[model samples]
Target: MLIANYLLTCGILQANAASGMAVHDDCKLKFLELKAKRTYRYIIYKIEEKQKQVVVEKLGEPANGYEDFTASLPADECRYAVYDFDFVTEENCQKSRIFFIAWSPDTSRVRSKMIYASSKDRFKRELDGIQVELQATDPTEMGLDVFKSRVN
Candidate 1:
């Protein structure tokens, strides 16, 4: 519940850095929270030590179980209460897990999506489609389309 409340208050700030490779301080802090919460089902993170940056995308599901975390933040639609974690490996390999759990203002259940062991270059390449989708409304989600419009 604390994590959900924290995420609601800090969601907007995290969205700002979502599009860019740069890490947000609040997001970094969330990592600490997640690290402590990882027990069985909440444990979703990856590490890649050979890339220039590490990235993690969030799911739109509840934080209680794997089946509950299957929501993928839709390509361009901006959903409230979206949260994820990002961290760089010791060698800067760019390995980390990301989950996005969608919720209503009341924190009601919604879909959630997740990904792990993603490298910077590979993720960006894959994000090309996501960028195209975000362009219509969530231009900020793509970070200048660094991955380009290859998806379309």
Candidate 2:
């Protein structure tokens, strides 16, 4: 009961107040372009552990693809990302979906993973209009097939 009460599930993430991290104001402003203005294809975020804040790591241009989004994440670290994926339905129509991804690669340190996992919910709630939420711990988990499967 104590563990359940401590880790509250918020939307697609678990909220752990232990970290007490704050979401930087700029994080939302940047997401607006991707969510409303369609100016960005993706946005990557990293936690400034020392500062106890989440900050934007990178913003993908409208011309960027899913591949670019995946490549932006470091091989041995954990990060958060948002991607504006444009897909065509069987009806030959164009549609787009915004995805919120929590990238916690297995190679990352235990402490680092714990921090990211704990802070994820606080950071994710700052952005609006995320249609899909994905938690990936390996490169294979972030592949296009996995994305396609989840997109539906």
Q: What is candidate 2's lDDT per residue for 1-152, written digit by digit as tens? A: 45534444422223433544788998999998889999899999998876778899999999988778888999999999998888887788899889899999888876677778777787777887889999999878778887777766
- Displacement of residue 139 (Cα, Å) in model 1 is 24
For all candidates in order, the CA lDDT equals 0.31, 0.82
Model 1 lDDT tens row, 30-144: 4445544532223222222233233343522334442243233334232322223334555666533433222222221221111111122343333211112122223233332
Native-to-model Cα distance after best TM-score fit, residue 45 in candidate 1, in Å:
12
Error of 1 at 54 (Å): 10
The ten-residue window of minimal lDDT in model 1 covers: 109-118
Please give the lDDT score at residue 3 for candidate 1. Answer: 47
lDDT of 2 at 79: 91
Off by over 4 Å in 2: 1-19
